[model samples]
Each structure stands twice: as C-alpha cells, then as structure tokens.
Target: MRHTWRWFGPVDRVSVQDAAQAGALGIVSALHHIPTGDVWPVEEIAKRQAEIAAGGLHWDVVESIPVSESIKTQTGAWREHVANWQETLRRLSAVGIKTVCYNFMPVLDWTRTDLRWTARHGAKAMRFDRIDFVAFDIHLLERPAAPADYDPETRDRALQRFRAMSDERKLSLSRNVGAGLPGSADGYSLPQLRAHLETYAGIDRDRLKRHLFDFLSEVTPVAEEVGINICAHPDDPPWALLGLPRVLSTADDYADMLAAVDRPANGMTFCTGSLGALAANDLPAMVRQFGPRIHFVHLRNVRREEDRTPCSFYEDEHLEGDTDMVAVIAGLVAEEKRRKTEGRPDHQIPMRPDHGQEILDDLTRGAQPGYPAIGRLKGLAELRGIERALSHLTYGLS
Candidate 1:
C-alpha cells in the first residue's frame, strides 16, 4: 500500500507538509476550486501537483473527481457534465495521475447522525446510531413515505426517539447529514436541506443505479485510454435511507457494476469502513474478489450493531472491528505481488486511513473528529507498521 493523506488542497487547514510530516508518502487530493460538472483544466492539475510535490510528497490519487448530481440523475445538462468528467480524466491522465477515486452516493456523501458522539473511552468518534437517523427522517425532516421505508419495529422506535430529542439535537442531526463535501454542496440551511432530500424522491435506487452504470459506460472508456483506473466508492452506510435507495452498498451491487462495463478501468475504491458498516459484506473476502480491479483503499473499521445500524467504532487496534485488516491487507499484498510478477497495471495500490477518532489532546480542541491529527497519526503509524511486517513476513525480506 502507498500511504496517502486526503488533503482538500490550498485551503485545507492540514497542509501538505503536515501530511508529509505524519509519514504519508502521497497526497490524495483534488482541484476543489473547480465546480462539479466542469472540466478540470490541465493547468490547475499541474498547479496542485506542483504544490504537493513542493511539500516533498507525491499526489497519489484524486480523493474524488466529483460526479455532479446532474450526471448521477442523468438530468438536465447530464451529457455536458459527463463530457466534462471524461475531459477531466483525460487531463488528469495526461498529467500522470493514474488512479482516480469516485462515488455514486446521491445527494449527501458519507453521513453521520452525530459528528461528535462521545465514546466510552472519553474521546469523541463519529456515530450513526439508528434511532437518531430514524428520528430525523421521520419527525424532523419528515420525508414523505419515510414510515414505509422503515420496518414496523423501527417505525415505532423512530416515533419514540423523535419525541425524546430536543430541537438542538434535531438541528445537529440534520446539519451533520446535510453537510456536503468540500467542492460539493455548501452547508445548507434546514429548509434548503429539506428541499435537497426531496429532489431525490423521483430517482429511486434503480434509477440511480442505471445512472451510475451509464456514467461508467461513458467515462470509463476514456479512463481506459488515458491509463487511469476509475474506482467507484461505495455508499457510506450501505443501505436505504429516508426513502432513498443506495445502489452501491453490496457485493452484488459491485458485481452489477463490473458487468455493466467489462473494462478493467471500472474498479472499486475498496473502502472497508463503508463496506464493513454492513455485516453481510465480508470485507476481506471482497478485497480478494476485487483484487484485480481495486485502485484505491479507505482502510478503517466500524462497530456494527446487531440491529445493523453502524457507528464509527474506535479505530480498532489493527485487525479489529468488523473488518479483518490483517487478512484484507495480506490479500492485497498477495494481489500486488501477483501483479508485480505478472507485469499487470495497477500493481501498487494507494490506501489511506479513512476516519480516526478525536483522542489525546485533540479531544480538547474542536476539530473534525475524524481528521484529528493525533488520532490519524496513531492510525497511520499502526497501519504502516502492519504493512511493513506483512511485507517482510510474506516476501521473506527483512
């Protein structure tokens, strides 16, 4: 694994130098200034790459070349938006960026009901308690058909949970879910977020899935020609939400994707945190299954409750949580070694610590819990040590 850190670029508080100091050899970044559905200029790519390289780090993967809502829904200007995406891929490839990570998650990206859920350990971790999400969906946001979306038991529990939350709790839950990506939707007011959720009402899971397949059909060929591997990120929670269908949440979902376009360029990001949120997904097994096509990895784990709603579990001492980090990384190592021997493309995959808790001194300051310096530094150090030991053990090298 090529260790990397996700940097939001120029404006990000965590500087490239900071990432390098943290022992990351590569920077996973993007041109966050460029709006969705627009072509990323080569000059802009060069500028950011130069900035990253200046900090003594290489730009490994584009955290995302964001797919606009228009493209995802195949709505107005979708053709133009997709054209811009392909052009961006071509430009990125021209600049020697070979691996591009993207996602098909609609509206909101990865969501958390509580951005600052206090762990039993006295540190704050991101959480997605079921009752909290259900409360927001059924009472506060009040999505039409939300009741039908939940099971009879969950529906009953949702009403009870809604009654328990104060107005402030409701606001926080809504804001946490609606808080968009860096170059994506800006922070939304309550009313605005309500409208945003409503926008996806007509585009159900099937529609979204078709749109994603169409997207791959269009841009993947360009990616193939440009020597870039286009890896689609999985849906965060890997389930339906507030009447919205999440298509990329299962192994079958990814199988559907690979079948849609038989190109090697169409790949998976292999985010264990996202896939591990669902108990049914065998994270390590999936890594082995998709080894040839995995271009990037978001290696982290989650504690999956029996009821199936997940919370950001503490950054498990490696190989903990639902994901078997050792088995997964060991499989990845074997795949990489095979690639090296067989002379295949995408031999060295880029991976990053997906999310870490706010611990140690970081818990005192109010930084984003997952991006806390100390916690992530600890995680990176552990993962690096694991990779090193695995390499030595497997390849018979010191």
Candidate 2:
C-alpha cells in the first residue's frame, strides 16, 4: 500500500511539511475552497498540486468533490450538478489525478455527535453517542417523524438526555452534527436541516439506493472515458441517522452498487473505521471481496461498547480496537499482489491512518478532531511494521 495523509489544503492545521515529515508518499485532498456543484477549473487544480509538490508529496487522490444533496434526491438543479460533476472529472483527469473518493450520504457527511469525547485512556477521541443523536433528532432539530424510527425505550432515553442539556449544550450538539466537516458541502442551520430532510420524506432505503444507481448511470461512463475511478466511500458509522436512509453501509451494499453500475470507474473507498464499526461486517473477508474495485483506504479503528448497535463508539488506538488490524492489512497486501498478477496499473492502493486519538502533545497542538499528528504518525508506524513483517515472512508483498 502507498501511505497517504488527508490534508485540508493551505488552511489545514496539519501542514504539507507535516505530511512530508510523517513519511507520507502521497497526499489526499480536495479543492474545498470551491463551492459544491461548481466545476473545478484546471487553474485551481494546478495550484493545489503545486502546493503538494512543494512538500515532495504528490496529490494522489481527491478525497472528495462532494455530491450535492440536490443530486441525491433528484431535486433542484440536478442536471446542472451532474454536468458540473462530469466536467470536474474531466478537469481533474486532465491534471493527471485519476482516483476520486466521494460519498453519497445525505444531509451530514460522516456524522459525529461528539468531537472531543474523552476515552478510558485519558485521551480524547471522536465519538458518535447514540442518545445524543437521538436527542438532536427528536428534541433539537425535531425531525417530523424522527421519534417513530426509535423504539419506546430509546425514545424515552433520548428525551431525558435532551431535557438534561442546557441551551448552550443543545446548540453545541446541533453545531457538532450540522456544521460541515472537511468535505461536507454546507453547514446546515436547524431550520434548513429540518426543511432539507423533508425532501426525503418518502425516499426510503430502496428509493435512496435507486437514486445512487441513477447517479452512477449519469457519471460513470464519463469517469471511465476520462481514466478516473469514482470510489464511493461507505456511510460513516454505517447506519441510519436523523431518520435518513443509508444504502452503502455494508458488504452487500458494495456488491449491489458494483452490480448495478457494472463499470470499471465505479468503485469503493473501503474505509475500515466506517465498515468495522458495525459488528456484522467481517473486515478481512470484505476487504478481499471488494479488493479489486477498491481505489482508496481509510485505516482507523473504533471501540464499540457492549451494546454497540443504535450507535455508541469512540475512536480507539489503531491496533488496539475491535478490528484485527494485522489480519486486515494482510488481506489488503494479498489483494495488491493479486492486482499485480492481473497486470492492473493501480496495483498499489493508497491508504491513510484516519481519525487518530488526541493524545500526548496533540491536545496542546490544537489539531483537528481525530487527526492529531502524533497519533496518526503512531498508527502509520504500526501499520507499516505489520506490512513489513508480512512481506518478509510470506513474500506476498514487497
């Protein structure tokens, strides 16, 4: 695997020089300055590329160019958005950047209820507190039919949790969930979020998924012709949130997506943290199964509580979480060898140790949530050690 780091371009707290010092062979980023649904002109792409090149790192993958909500529901300006998306692909491909990682999750991109939840180890980690989310859904944003999605006991618990919150705390919860993350298109206000979600009132899992397939139908051919791979990142937390439907949450979702599109450009990002959060997803098996079409990887681990479902998890140390990091890496290594044997140009896939815990001097550094420089450096070192040991013992990877 070619090690990479996620950089939020010029304004990122983690600098390009920091990525260089971390020994990342490639940098994963996007033109975040540009608004959603706008074409990424060649000039802007070249500028960002030059910045990365200055740090001796090449921009390997576009972490995203966010799929707009309008396109997801086939609502306003959908055709124009698709046209701009295709044109962005053409522009990106022209600049020699072929692999693009994107996600179709509506409303919030990778929802998290808490950004600084303290772990048992005294370090801080990003957490998705189930009750907090439910509280926000039912009590804060007050989604029309949100309470119906949860059972009586869960709903009661969420109500109690919401009641406990002061005005400031409630607003903080709303901001945490709605304020746009790195690749999220817009930071939604409460009224705007409530109104936007209403659009999906009748669009359940089946219809949302159909919309995803329709999206691929419009853009995959252009991607294939342009030598670009559109890797759809799995839904973070791998489940429903705010009463929204999540289609790309499991292994079956990937198989269904690939079968529906049947195009080489349509692919998977294979984020372990997102998929591994769900107990049902067998990490190693899923890695092997989806290996051929996987264009990128996000390596991170989450510690799920005894009662993990309905969402309760915190970011854990890379090798110490529920996921078997060694076994997962071994599978990825084998898959790379398989790709090489098949004579594929993208045999060596790019990976990044995502969402590291806030520990050591990281707390003082004021790093972005779950992206402490020291923490990720520790994760990358551990993953590299495993890759080296496997390659040395089995000759399966070099």
Candidate 3:
C-alpha cells in the first residue's frame, strides 16, 4: 500500500509540497486544464510531470482522462474523441504514468447537496441529502418521471421543501446538483442539461453498458500496448439519479465490465466512499473480491442513513463510517503480497485518503472542498498507521 495524494495541478491551494509534507509518496492528478476529449500531448503531460517531480513526488496515476459525453453516447465526433483518448493513454504511459483513472458517470461526475455540511464535531464535511436532491430533481430540475423514482412520502417532502424554498435557495440547489467536474469547476444550465438529456432519449442500462463496452473495445488494446491500466471509477451515489443510468455502481456492474473485455488494461478504481454510499455494497468484501483488478484506491468514509435505499450521507473521518476500513486495508495488504509473490511490478497499489473534512486552520486555507490539507494529512496518517499495523501483523515486518 503506497500512499498517494490527489493534487489538482500547481494552482491548487493545497500544493504538492503539502502532500509531501503529509507523507504521501506519489500524486494522483491530471491535466485538468485541458478540455474533455482533447488530446493530452506529450508536451503537456511532461509539463505536469516536471511540476510533481520538483515537489519530490512521483506522478503515479492520472485520476482521470475524462471519458467525454461524445464517447459515451456515440454521437458527434465520438470516434475522434476515442482516438484522442487512446493517444492520451499512450502519451501518459510513455511518460511513466501507467495507471489512468477515469469515470463513466453521466453529466455530473459526483453530486452533493452541500459541500460543507457541518459535522457533529464542528468540522465541515461534504454531504448529500436525499431530500435536498429529490427536491432539486422533481421541483427545480423537474426531470420527467422523477416522481416514479421515489416513494410518495419522499415526493411529498420534496414538494413541500421546494414550495417553501426561496429563489436563492432554489438556485443553490440547482447549481449543487448539476455541478459538473469539480476540478474544472464546470457545469451546465438546466435547459442546456435538458438538451444533453435528450441525446440519450432511447438509451437505458443495457444500452449504456454496450456503449461502455464499445468504448473499451476501442481503447483497451491501445492501453494494453501502452502498458496502461485503465481503472474505471465507480459511480458516486451508486444509483440512478434524475433518470440517468449508473452502470458502474455495483460489484455485478464491475463483473459485467470485466466480462465485456477481459484484459489487464481493463480494471477498476476501488473507491470506498462512493461504493459505501449504497447499503448493500459490502465494501470490505468487495475489497477481497476485486482485489486483484483494483489498480488504484480512494480511501474515505461516508455515514449513510439507515432507513432508506436512496439515503442521505456525509463524508466521515477515515475510520468512523460504516466501511470496515481496517479489513479493506488488510485485504489490500494481502493482495500486495500475492502480487509480489507473482513477480508483478506494481505490487504496491497507489492509494490516497480521499475526501476529508475541513478542520483546524484548513477552515481558512482556501483548499478545494474535500481536499483540505490538514484533514487529508490526518486521514493519511491514520491510514498509514493501519497499513503499518497490517503489514507488521501479516508478515512480522514493515
């Protein structure tokens, strides 16, 4: 288990120096400045490489080379976008960045009703309230068929919430739910998003799966040739939202993904917080099941509500939430042992303490919502301790 930190390029308030200070050996980042579906030329990749190297950190993985909407829908310039994506993989591999993390979540990369929901301990944590989201989808976005997705009680509460909300609160809800790629701070207006939705008029889960497989068919070979592991990030919330299909939400989904294309290049990013959002995901068990194929990992926790399927949740401290993080770490340690025994080069998986609370001076640090310097440093310290204990207990050595 190699410690890594997600660094959003040089402009990020939490600098590469901060990650190193926090004992992270590598950086999980991307050329987020480049637009989606664009070719990340070797020059651009190298420029980012130089930046990380200067901070005494390795550019271990690309957290995403975003799979554009065009590629997902097989529409306008999709073929071109696939080619560009393939080229990006080759370039990244050539620059010694072999693991590439990307996601298939439609429209929004991740949705949260509040970025700073106050924790009981007085720190600010990212949160997703089902009620707030339902209010947004059914009342504000008015997504067709939204009522059918929820129970009548939920809809009633949503309706009441919407009716009682002021115009400012409604706009806030819209922006929060429709919020796009956070790294890029990009998003779409309601009408614009509605038009985007129309592009998928006839598409459903099976169709989306086929499209994803088609995408893999085009790029996996290129990735294999380039020695890149294509780690697909699971869908956040791990459920359908606003009538959009979330194909990468469960273990079965990943099983199907692997069966679609059985290649080492086709793998997954084990994200505990996202998978833990759903009650039935069995995160620690998933860690054991998908152990070999998980190329990168995001270690974070979420406190999910108990009473409902689509429940409210807020990010928790690394070890506090429902996820059995110690067991997951032990699973990872065992996998690392197997890989080393098998003579695999990437025996130590690159992992980062994912989303964290904003505490201490981080309250004024101007850091990105979940990437607070002090908070992540704390989580990383805790995770590092877990790894050490597991490594020592399993092998009697670090």
Measured against the true structure, the TM-scores of the candidates, in listed sequence, are 0.93, 0.96, 0.97
Of 1 and 2, the candidate ranking higher by lDDT? 2
**Index of the highest-TM-score prediction:** 3
Q: Which 10 consecutive residues of model 3 have the lowest summed lDDT?
A: 389-398
Model 1: weakest 10-residue lDDT segment is 310-319
Q: What lDDT is obtained when candidate 2 is compared to the true structure?
A: 0.88
| lDDT (Cα atoms) of all candidates against the true structure | 0.80, 0.88, 0.89
Best-fitting candidate, scored by lDDT: 3
Clashing residue pairs in all predictions, respectively, total: 0, 0, 0
Q: After superposing candidate 1, which stretches have Cα over 4 Å from the reference? A: 182-185, 309-319, 364-366, 393-398
lDDT (Cα, tens digit) per residue for candidate 3, span 1-398? 88999999877999899899999999999888898999997788889999999999999999889999988888999999999999888888887888999999877788999888899879999999898899988877778888899899889998898889899888887877777766775788899778788787788999999999999999999999989899999999898888888899999999999889998879999999999999889887888888889999999999987556788999999999989998888889889999999999888899999989999998888788889999999999999998888788555343
Q: Against the true structure, what is every candidate's RMSD?
A: 2.3, 1.6, 1.4
Residue 366, model 1: lDDT of: 54
